[model samples]
Target chain A: MSEDLRERFPEAEWIDSHDQDVVRIAPDQLLEFGNVVHEAGFEVLADVTAVDWYRTRTPRFDVVVNLLSMQHRRRLRILVGVPDGDPVVPSLVPIWPGANFGEREVYDMFGITFDGHPDLTRILMPDDWEGYPLRKDFEVGAVPVQFKASHQVN
Target chain B: MTDKTIDDPEIEEVDLWVSGTEEAEWDVYSTDEGAQKMRLEETGARLTEQLGSVVTDDYDLDDIITEDERMIINMGPQHPSTHGVLRLQLELEGEMIRRSKCVIGYLHTGMEKTAETLTFLQGPTNVTRMDYLAPLHNELCFSLAVERLLDIEVPPRAEVIRILMTELNRIASHLVAMATNGMDIGALSIMTYGFREREQILAFFEKTTGLRLNHNYIRPGGVAADLPPGWRADVSDICDTITGRLTDYEDMLKENPIWVGRTRGVGVITAEECRAYGITGPTLRSAGVPWDLRKAFPYSGIENYEFEVPVGEHGDVYDRYRVRIEEIIQSVGIVRQAADAMPKGDFRIDDRKVTPPPRHRIDESMEALIHHFKIFTEGFRVPAGETYVAIESPRGELGCYLVADGTGKPWRMHTRAPSFYNLQALPIMMADSVVADTIATIASLDPVMGDVDR
Candidate 1:
């Protein structure tokens, strides 16, 4: 399947990570690639998430979309590299409506925007949330606990 | 305001009919409305529009029903029948739900964000809380993803044990679903009966994992421990007991007129709608898809066992009920198979880096002590990569997406929670249905709040 995908789209770089096929493509090619796979019986959009590589990689975030072909019993991972400045990727909701909440979750957590989403609002977080919590730069925001009678022993 | 009486001749008698309209307008005409009220009204309208179009086709219903007769109402976040903290905003035209939207995130604790700080060894503990009803399945998915990244395999004994425990967990989860479903529909006795039977399974789990709810027992290298002594007898006892009790459930609800009437035609979702919405597990099977991940994409040697995947013709609430009931029986068969074929070998992998030495060895040997201490404190590093592993939980496809960075801590840990995706099907199922049937539909989906909000 990877060989077939590679033969079809030579511009996209395919990497086999732990025996799973991951095709890395530019943000512009996400919708087209999604359509290609959708036409090829990859009907289920299993998940859509983004990873923020703060200060480690050039194209700072990788938007990962997991697709499942129920007909063939195969899975494919599509990765789109978005620059730190513009973290926008075309929404797969047009192809797969199941991507609605998953894309909204990515938007809520990683601050990445889905350009063509029907309703691009926060799904899991509050509407008034300040920053994306899943980004690498986001602080864990641990609060110090104060004990009633015990003090820290040095 | 004019004093209107019940005998007013201008009022029209509303009859229930399934409207073929795709769009409806929510126009609030109040001069003294507050900002909060306006914001809520707008959100409700947007949600209705977003959700209504997925299941309905564009048509005009203005001639039949007026805008004034259509009102938006909130169901829960507190209602007993919502399963947990799930809230629904329904656009109703005289008791019939024209459109609906699901409002969630009341229980979001940011577990995914918290996963980045925990090591692979502690990963199962965090994920196990997501779907509290099926905690072991959550742990199993996470452990599978981590093991895939590490490129290691557990012993045959461990795999069989996983299959046995997970299949038992499946039965317990389906029992809860059946119980709550019955309770929602006002059959309160089934709730007690279902929980009573589920206690046997929980007791077995407590004997093995030491916790009833969040058993972080399924770790990355393998399960936390081997099966307890006399497990085979306990498993067979559970199977026999539940197998007998299942007939009672069938006799009570399967042919009951009220049960069939309430659930048969309510909450109908087609196979195409399920595929488009990414609904899996029993819900999809109820739509006659036969797309069980355990069979289609076998994991943890589940394919070695012989079992049938039960499917339903209509995608209604009753079909879902029947599918789940049959699934429990099938799960019992798988458990029996796994127990009989259970291998006698090491419970965990033999790798010293991933699996700690035994407790007796750690007390005797100095090298074992250091290895145990180091394994618990720092944890083992996984090769830098990303992997997504999915398993069939009671709800649907419970998936774990893990990204390791050559460090003890994971770079990113995201769970594709089944309840979260299955919740999307609520609007489609609730559309064109009555206000009362909403409870039946929500119960049929069997969504856990922790899984939905996580």
Candidate 2:
């Protein structure tokens, strides 16, 4: 089914979802997620999600998409590669504006940014918050204070 | 507040020191209003050399706010529309904000630190707690990251089930955003409707995963179980019901003059600044950037499916609402497809390295029982390497970076949360906008504190 849709929509490429058995796509192809096949009639944005590769050669996170078209009655997928130094993939706000908040969340919890997104700020934590909690190695609290308790607390 | 004796907890106030030549004196109080209190003069240029950014890159304090007449107002760590414990120190000239400094960490839970000490596969079970509303999405992102390092392939059925569960959770997560955004604008009924729909989704989750919120169902190499009996029918029913309620939510908020007036022209940030600041998701969409991770990188079984990426005219609250509302319809369609085309196979990989033997095997086979015991106690070893994986979570990009030194326990782990990065651009978005619009702007972003401060 996915192959037929790809053949139907010449602008798309097929991505292997490892052995998970679903076809995936790349981030640059994000705009064509559902609309390219709109002529064939798929109008749903089933999911916009990501995955983190803790042991990648570059140690970066990969963003993935799972799209559904109710009109054409089909499905599609996409993938984005983000660097560890700056895990920033372009925000899909302009394509599927619904992604605005979800992408912001990916930034907040994981610290990977959605580039070109407007209003990038702390939605959950304070604006000056530090650390991305979702990263596999993110420290939960301030590093343990080294010295003994300075004094007694009330 | 730190542990101290008898003395009043001295708040580390901002931009208030006049610099007494001989005395290291600071007012230790918030500024009057809207005054951008830079760290240079107050901390003094001498301190930068003493102890500041070791990697300084021309952060000109002079280029910081020059206007002296601005008044300062602190919004949060306790103020509304901050989403969760965010504290914004805003410099305002009456209603116009001149400069803004954000103060965070009041809600930090140290979730990442905990991950480092735990076994690798157990990591996903913990991360789901951070972004509580979108638990499955969080689990999927973290699980895939570990799988990448191990270079393992999950079973086909497991992958499809994960896609179905996480997508349903995505709709539920978006509903929370919608509900809270409405509550911020005093549209109480919308919150009820939003949560009302979310409740059904949660109920479905309980049926499959046995938990409502932070379910540890999506594990490395596969899921915890096959879909429960009648899961398809339950999920289908949910999709159908939500389809009807979504219209009610639209009627309540979409294009309503008050909502439009408050959200449409409020908190405008153009695409250029957005890119420069490293932003993404709906906020980026509002600015006219059409990038999305789903179309960019298809993982699990997403590539086999089809869907839409809804764009907006203006990067504003109104446009965001339209996008999300349309997305709910999209989510319904995705669920429908998964139910209609879900493949059949073992839910988890055959490798005992990831999962323990089935309970039945434990009774007759000594190896199976021993393997189960070992997995529960020692966890499986992973290749000595580091890897990072990112997923397009409800709040943008959720990523995990892990380091393994040929041990079950991860040597180091890091999460690249989209919330922290996106939150940096709030000043640019809310600076010139009125205080009233700030609420709308934040609501549109729909940030969650657990994920933000995890």
Candidate 3:
């Protein structure tokens, strides 16, 4: 199946990660690639998430989508890289409505915008949230434990 | 509506037409005459204006009604029937619902962010809390992903133990679902019965995992420990007790007229809709798609077990209930089979790099002591790679996506929570239904808010 997809979309970079086939595509071709895979009988968009590689990798974010073909009982992972400056990818909601919440979550966590989503508002964060929490640069805010009696350490 | 005008000293005319239009201003009346004139000139202009010029004969009922008559209300971030912090925005025309939107994220605690700091061994402790009802499955999914990345296999005894514990967890989870669905639909007695049955299973879980809810027992290498002594007798007791009580539950609610009337035809989702929405587990099975991960894509030697996947034909609320009930029985059967075929060997993997040395070995050998110390303080480093592993939980397909950067701690760890995906189909199920049935439908979906918001 990976070989078939590789032949069809020659531009895609197929990386074999721990025996799982990961097809990395550019942001612009996401919708077309999604349509092709949908036509190929990947009925379910199982999950959508993004990983931020701050200062370590070139294109700062990789939006990962897991697709399941229930009829054939197969799974496929599709990755689209979004540059730090312009973190926008075409939404897969048209091909799979199940991608709606997953895409919203990716947007909420990584600050990547899905272009054609119906409602692109934050789903897992407050509407007035300041920054994306899941980004590598985002600080894991830690609160100091205040001792009741301000004791001095030796 | 007029009584509000008389109460306050700063009295103003109570415009019942646009009462709560303060927030969503788009629903308010447009004062622009040019736009109104354009709408008047084109007969289908109103349809085009609302729907982007795609004029069709089948117009929405909301399009015909004035905005004043159509009420939009928030069901909960607090209502009892909402299951947890789930809030629903319902667009209503009298008692019937025109549309509904599930407003989630009240319980988001940034667990995924926290998982990045935790090691592969500590990953289970975090993911286990995602689906509190089925914590073992969450741990199992995470452990499977970590094991996949590490390229190691657990002992045969460990695999059988995992299947045994997870199947039991499935039964306990379905019991809670049955209890809550009954409570929402006004069958209060069944709620008590369901919990009473589940208590027995939880007892068995407590005996094994130590904690009741967040049992961080299943780790990357294997389960935390071997099965407790006398587990066979306890398993037999639980199976026998649940089997007897299920018949009692069937007698009370299965053929009852009120139960049938309330659930028989409510919240219908077809097989195609289930696929499009990524619904799975009992909900998908209720739609008559017998696509179970344990059966289709067997993991952890589950294919070795003999069991049947029960499916429902109608895909209604009743069908979901029926599917869960039947699933509980099948889970019991699997548990019995696992206990019968329980293998005897080392519980966890033998790799010293991943699995810590046993307590006896640590006391005897200095090298074993250092290995144990190293495993705990710095944790084992996994080869840099990424993998996604999914297992069937009670609600749906619980998945774990793990990425390693050749460090003890994970680079990124995310759980594909089943409750999160299943909640996406709630609006489709609740559309065009009466307001009262909304509670029943949400209960039927069996979403755990911790799982949804995480």
Candidate 4:
């Protein structure tokens, strides 16, 4: 599967980070690459998450997807670079129906849009929530918690 | 609701008395309460304006219903059988469901957002609250992710202890599932019997970790402490007690005609549907997919343990029940073997950077004191990298993905909560089933809202 991913997209960088097969693909090729991986027997789309590399890297966000091959007992990590402005990636919902809530979550937390997601509404946050709470610059909004001493009886 | 609570004289709010001063009076509400209310209102207004365009144009109940005569109803944010705070919008044709949508985030606590702020040493403290029913699994997953990032090896005894503790927690969690499933299905006696056996396991937990639930015993490099004296006997007794009670559960529910009738053919989702929905644990196992993480992706040396991955032939509510029952027995066997072959060694790694010095050493040596103080204050740093660690949590394959940026705090932490994914199967399962069967479908999934909303 790793070799096929490399052959299909010559631009894809195969990385070996943290004992898992990590592949960095372009944002544009994400949907196509996912199709190839699915065809290569990676049946389980384990998780989909993003990391905010705002100041450290050019393409500010890294959208990470973990895939598991139950047949071969193997796993792979696919990372796609998404920039800050117009941060959009093709949706994997068409390929894997399981990415529905996960893509919605990435959209909710990081403000990264998945273009073809069926229902691209917020999953974890309220519909009216303003900022992406998981972004690096986004403040962890706090409410004042007043501590009042309890009274005692004799 | 407000009128009844305020009008009832028996429901008066408790009065407060200050302890320090002679006046001994305390006002529960702050004097600036009005200002606080105003700020909250402003925040609400701003949110409404930002999302106004999208919220109004979102999915309509009219779109899901096939005909104008079809009825649309809200199942619950507070429904008893929907499990914790899960609201379902059901479009029904008579009593049969046509299409359903699950509305979640009622219990959202932003645990992943919170993990970035806490140091690696404190990360487990936050994640453990995610799965309140199976907290040890949450802690173990988070700890394993951190340990993988740090590239540290745990002591042999600590690894064995972790397996032992997590297996016991799996049994306790499944018992809660059994209890709630029975209560949801109207078998009231099973609730009492299940909790009665679960309490014995919690007693063992308290004796070992000094807490009934959410024991933060497992740490990044190793466990927090060694097993207390006579823990072997305590665990042995717990296994024996629960193993005997397992048969009682079978007798009550296994062949009972009503139980069989309600669950046998209800809430059926084929193995293909389960895979597409990314469901795992017993729900996936009940569909005849033997894709358990313990065997597929062995972490923390689970390969050494000998156990069976119970699978069900028919992927119905009854099959899910049978799978959980068999799992409890297997957990008892694993615990017995672990107790008999408990290794003799340190409970934590010897690395001073991760694990603290001994209490006696801290008193005798000045350097040891400073090292202990520093380790507590500024935690050990991890190299810049990212990793994903998964374990066979009670619900499913609970996974933790961690990204470190060469600092004590994590760059980003995301938990692949099994319940969050498993709950997605609700709409699939609810389609074409009767309204009464919704309760059975939900109880079979056994999703904890903490795990879902985290």
Candidate 5:
């Protein structure tokens, strides 16, 4: 499967495989590459999520997908970069209905936009929710901390 | 109409409709399973059955009404049976439920969003809290995914420990399911027995991981600590107690007629639907599907163990209960085998970045102290790549989809929570039943809101 990914997506890069998700490609190929992977065998949507780089990352947003193919028993990971300014990527909802809430999650967290998602509104937070809370730059003081004043879990 | 709770047995609004004239009233839906046709009562209190199962042939004429009305009602943010903080909008026929649409997101804590801010090593701490009942399984999946990204192998001792803790946690989680499901079913004492056994395992977790609940013991390279003194005996004690207690639970309710009536043929989900919905773990096994990740993918040296995947013959709620009971016995066996084969070696990988130094060395050497300090503070970095690791967790296949940008923190963290896939079948199961059956159906799904809402 790794060799097949390399051969098919020659322009795309295969970076690593964590547990089962073989990570490949970049931000530029997020949509097309995802379509290609869907065509391969991965039928389930799995999940779509993001992580913040604070400042060290190149594009600042790491977009990811977990795809499972029950027929082949293989899982694929697709990761893409979203630059700071636009933070936009095409939605995979047209292909998978499960991506509905997950894509909205990315939008609400890292301020990433899912271009063509049917309903890209907030799912977790309030409809009038402010700035993305999951961004590296987003401050955590929007809500008061009352759990503890002295001890932090970390 | 949008998202309402479909409750009540009396069909007033949906069944009968009265127009401009009070005399020209037509009945819409009946509670009968096979009665077909229309009933025009001046009052819109009852409907004819073409889609429902309430017997309408012997309709009581005592409560005849002169007026007709319909209503759409919403239930829950406080209702626990919706599974989480799920909201449902129902279209009603008087007291009879007509249609229901669900609204979720009342319990979402944004854990997936928060995972990106912390380092990859810090990811497990965040993920485990999502599914409180199955925390160890959460940590295992995330750590394994990270290890796979680094392409590093953990020591034999570490692998054994991981398998031991994870299988035990699976049993513990299933116990919570049995306990709460029993409570929902009115078998109150069964809950206490389940919790009693669960506490024994929780004590073992506290012994090794310091924290009892979210023990991030299963790190990328290996476990956080070596096997503590008397760890083997402690685990064996719990397993033995659980083995004995399980039979007692069977004696309490297995043959009881009330227990049989509630679950025998209720919530019958066929194996084909289980496949279509992509359900896993006990739920799928209960539906007669053979698709466990341990048997199919066999990660973290699960191939080394001698255990059988217990499956249910019927796709009913009763079969699901039996499958979980059998799984507890099997998990006990796996934990015992792993403990018997525990190796005398290092508990983590040799890589300094992923694994910390020996405890004694920190007191004697400056390099070891510095490494410990750095590991505790900045954490370790992984090669820029993405990975998704799926393990057979108690509820189902708990998989961690991680994207690492060659930094100490993760780029993106996505959890493939079983509740999400398993909950898809709720509408199918609850459609033909009475409102009272709602409690049983939700309990049978055995979902944790944290897993669902996250």
Candidate 6:
């Protein structure tokens, strides 16, 4: 199946990292690659998460998709690198409806957008939240802790 | 101002229907004077002409219902039946739910972001809090991913112990689901029976790990501590009690008509719908899918366990209940086997860097003291790599995606929480159901809000 992926999309880079089949596709080729893989019996999109290698890597974020085939009982990890300027990837909602909330979660945490998602509103974060909490550059402990005085009768 | 009763109009012999040009008619006689009378007459005339007919009008019932007729009700970020701070925006037409959308994030603590801050050793400590119901599974998944990234194998005894603990944890988790689900569905007695059995299992856990819920016993290299003396005895006792109690539960719920009536066909989701929503664990099994990670992927020596993957024919609330009930029995069998085949060896790996030196050696030898100091002061670094490891958690597929940057701390750590994906199916399950059945549906989904919003 990895070989098939490589043969089908020669432009994409396939890396077998730590016994897991990981394919690195161009940001634009995600939808096309996803379509081929989805056709190749990987039905379940098990997970969708993002890695923010802000200044260390050329691409700011690596949107990771863990595709699992219930029939084949194999997992394939697809990584699409979205660069800093655009920070967008074509949504996989059209192919797999399960990617809806997962993509929204990734967007909520990392501020990476899924372009074609029907409702890509912030999930797991407040609508007025200031910045992407999962980004490497985002400052932690920015919000101060307030503890009100306790009132108890002696 | 004086309180006065206005004169009441007396009913005379009158015809029920009026044949007045199929239009609304109002009497022109009035006590009003000047422009008010003229304005009322003009408004009446305009309304009658535009509307055409009022009382005797022939109209389709659907035409009268507009978008405004369907009411939008906010169920909670506070209601008790939602299980947690899950706010549901439900569109209702009378008592029927037209559409529903779940609004979460009330419990989002940014644990994934916090995981990036903690070292690999401390990673489990943070993640174990995510799915509070099944914390052992959370810790085990995280530890497994780290172990894979580090390229190390745990000892045999450690693997068997992990299987033992997590299986027990699965049973405990199932008990909570059963208890809460029963209470939500108005089968109140089942809650008492379920929790009574659950407390026994928790007692066994506390005896082994010294904590009830968030036992961070499973570490990267191996478990945190060796199983205490007579652990097997306690496990066997708990297993027997649970085995007997499971029968009681069956007697109470399985044959009871009220239990069956409330749950038999409520919140039904087809196998295809479950696959589309990525629902897993017992809910998927209830839909007749035998895709259990323990059976499929076989991590942590799960392949050795002799157990049956219980499945249901119809994907209804009752089927979900049956699957979980049968699973608890299967888990008990696995626990008994693990106890019988319990190996005697080092609980943790013998590597000095991963596992600290023995306390006796630390007191005696300077070399041991130095090694312990170095290990504690600066945790061991893992080789740079990324891996995703998933296990069959009680809720569903609990996966941990870890990326190490050749440092003590992880570069990025994300837990693919089962409750998060499982909760997404709530809208799918609640679609076109009664507004009242939302409680049964939410209870059956069994989403831990901590897992959902984490």
Which candidate number has the best DockQ?
3
True contacts kept of each: 0.64, 0.09, 0.70, 0.59, 0.32, 0.62
Please give, for residues B1-454, the per-residue lDDT of candidate 5 as tens digits.
5444466545355656555444435333232221111222212212221111122122232233333553456666678655567665544456654434345667887787678777777888898898888888899999988888888899999999999999889889889888888888899999898898899899899998987799988888888888789998998898889988888999987998998889887766666555544566787898776668998788889999998888887777888888889899999999999999999998888888887788899999999999999997888888887666788888887888777878787766778888766665554455445556667767777887788777
**In model 5 chain A, which range of ten residues has the least summed lDDT?**
A15-24
| Model 3, span B1-454: residue lDDT tens | 4665566887875767665455654522233211111121123322232222121222245557766777767889999999999988776789977666677889999999999988888888899889999999999999999899999999999999999999999999999999999999999999999999889989988999898889999898889999999999999999999999999989988999999999998988888878887889899999899999998789999999888999999999999999999999999999999999999999999998899988999889999999888888889999998999999999989998999999999999999999999997776777667899998999999999999998
Candidate 2 residue B53 Cα shift, in angstroms, is 22
* Model 1 chain B worst lDDT window (10 residues): B29-38
Q: What would the TM-scores of all predictions be?
A: 0.90, 0.69, 0.90, 0.88, 0.77, 0.88
CAPRI category for model 5: incorrect
The residue ranges of model 1 lying beyond 4 angstroms of the native Cα positions read A1-4, A142-154, B1-51, B55-64
Q: All predictions: root-mean-square deviation over Cα?
A: 8.3, 11.9, 6.6, 10.8, 11.1, 12.1
Q: Which of the two candidates, 3 or 4, achieves a greater lDDT against the reference?
A: 3
Report the C-alpha displacement of residue B198, candidate 6, in angstroms. Answer: 0.8
Q: Which candidate, 3 or 4, has the higher DockQ?
A: 3
- Write one digit per residue (lDDT tens) for candidate 1, span B1-454: 9987879998787876664442356333222221112133334334544344554443233427666888888888899999889888787888787777787888999999999999999999999999999999999999999999999998999999999999999999999999999999999889999999999999999999998889999999899988899998999999999999998999899999999999998888888878887898899999999889999889999989999999999999999999999999999999999989999999999999899999999888999999999999999999998999999999999999899999999999999999999988887888777899999999999999999888
Q: In model 4, what lDDT does residue B11 have?
A: 88
Cα lDDT tens digits, model 2, A17-107, are 3332244445555555545643444333333445556775444676654444433434455556667876767766554443544565567
Q: Give lDDT per model, in order.
A: 0.88, 0.68, 0.86, 0.84, 0.74, 0.83
1 versus 6: better DockQ goes to: 1
**Could you report the DockQ of all the candidates, in the order they appear?**
0.44, 0.07, 0.47, 0.32, 0.19, 0.36
lDDT for position B250 in model 6 = 86
Model 4 chain B: ten consecutive residues of lowest lDDT: B33-42
CAPRI grade of model 6: acceptable
Candidate 2 local lDDT, B69-166, one digit each (tens) = 55667788787778888777665656765556565556776666677678866887789888888889888887887888788899888888988998
Native contacts kept (model 1): 0.64
